[model samples]
Target: MAEQPTRAWYATLRHLWLDERDARRAVPPALAERLRERVAASERRHSGQLRICVEGGLPPSYLWRHLRWRVPMPKLVHQRALMLFSRLHVWDTEHNNGVLIYLLLAERRIELVADRAVARRVDAQAWSALVRDLGEALHHGRFEQGLLQAVDGVTELLAPHFRPADDGPRPNELPDEPVLR
Candidate 1:
């Protein structure tokens, strides 16, 4: 396990406020809708479900409690993503082929969580590259481009394992809209 970094209170405040103040500029409503549509289209190609979420930062509750900040950023992001993965019912797919692409704009970090079916087929290294590439685009202020590119990547990766049904279309197990925090 990695050691948790304890950041100063001021550092935490800066990250929370600075990122929240500019979330609209980072991923405006128009771009968010576009990304949502991209996911919808991508899901049609594969039975697996794909969802994208962008959060401004850790909740204010964490800031209120000092010890929570002692938790590492990666760990916080992973924990929140996992919670949303279940809360949003990403694991409800018939084939366990659900994926969530979570971005913590405050930390400039990307986290991808997939259900069991996806884990069985895709390599962790491949997912790491996809996340790295998406994070790069975000760092460069290419929010829509980065998200769309990742959606395409997820579509390609799962299309082989969960092909479209021949008799009838597969249901949209999850919503395509981006969950903004």
Candidate 2:
């Protein structure tokens, strides 16, 4: 694996200043509800699960690792996404096609984590391009639009490999609501 790029000191301070309130403000209740509905609708088209997690800042442990080990912020953020993927049980779906769309508000960074089956089909470059486009929208404060596009992007990626048969709804292995932390 490649080494994570280290962030500057100011970035650490910025992360320390944010909390759950910042996350809530960025994605308020109404928008979150809309995103949840979007995820639900998107899931109906395929046999994949999507979990959205918007975190305001890195927890102390992540920060500690970054500060002490000079770990790159991107890697740390990706690690957090993977941790949530497992913790939220996104990996337990029957088809092994669950995906996590994780946004770190403090860093204005997005990470996508895919289950084994989905990862095998989608290349890393495709995910990178999707994240880059979503980050641009997010940097402009278009959180709702950015997240919607992200969910759609994941759906598009999964549909080719995991589309359901007979137009019937697939089992929802995970909750649709976007988690704010």
Candidate 3:
């Protein structure tokens, strides 16, 4: 597993900020200043760490069949997947003899940290489903979908309680279209 920063997320944030700035540029001087101030305030409030964890696993009966499917399967597999599918830098480390993926998109200040042991216990189908759902949610700017996916990926035995943080503006509250330049 590789952990890396997400470039798309940063691009999205920068694009949004630029759009807002452009929109305010056309307003009256006083109003433009107010708008800029409001945008700055909102940006300050929204900027923070967003952490997401997903559990992964294969059925116990399939353990033997998936012996080679363990986290950090092979360097080639990691490189190939990261090269083709990943948009961020992925860092890997050992924990409890299992792999842990730590990805930080510092520009967006978003971190995705997950334990491989949790992933190893869950079936691939279920894990894939969670990832797909979460990915779609993220692409559509729906953080709640990401949260739900994370909650659902956990096993009953190791499920952790997560209280949603009231950090920034919800997706719905953000403008659907970027403020035109």
Candidate 4:
């Protein structure tokens, strides 16, 4: 793991102020539907599974862990993303090519977690670059554009290894909707 930056002193209060409503506002129903369509379309070209999760804030449990364990904010956020990656079953795909694009609204942090199959093929710097690019868009409140580009980016990365021989519909191992929380 990369060395985590120190936690901001005001991080707790910031998280407390955000909630599911913020997530919903950031990704409204129409935008969520668009993202779902993008993911579905991307899946049709490859065997990989993609999941997008936008969270307004860290859960209380993670907040408590941060306080007690003195975990850096970045590490804590990454942990939350990884936990969701597992809970959402992004790692259970037939090709082991699942990818999770996660966003924390309160912190404006983005974490991309790829299953081992995809991870081994892609470089860590590539993942970091994707997250950084998405972070720039999110910082500018270009949520829809950012997510669409992210889906396209992830699809490009996975297509080389997972593309199907034919254009027939691929098995969808996960829901396409962006999880708002």
Itemize residue pairs with steric clashes in candidate 1: none
> For candidate 1, which ten residues in a row score worst on lDDT?
1-10
Two-way TM-score contest, 3 vs 4, winner:
4
Candidate 3 segments exceeding 4 Å error: 1-116, 155-181
Worst 10 residues of 3 by lDDT: 97-106
| lDDT by residue (tens digit), candidate 4, 113-171 | 99999989988888888888888887887888899999999998988888764756656
- Please provide, for model 2 over 50-113, each residue's C-alpha lDDT reduced to its tens digit, 9 standing for 90 to 100: 9999888999899888878888888999899999999999999998999999889888888999
RMSD, one per candidate, in order? 3.3, 3.7, 16.8, 3.8
Ranking by TM-score: 4, 2, 1, 3
Q: Could you tell me the C-alpha RMSD of candidate 2 in Å?
A: 3.7
Q: Is candidate 1 or candidate 4 better by TM-score?
A: 4
Q: How do all models score by TM-score?
A: 0.87, 0.91, 0.28, 0.92
Which one wins on TM-score? Answer: 4
For candidate 1, the TM-score is 0.87
For residues 24-112, what per-residue lDDT tens digits would candidate 1 score against the true structure?
A: 66778898889888988888787889988777777766544535536655677688789889988998888898999988777777899
Model 1: C-alpha RMSD to truth? 3.3
- Model 3 lDDT at residue 141: 59
Extract clashing residue pairs from model 4: none
By lDDT, the better pick of 1 and 2 is 2
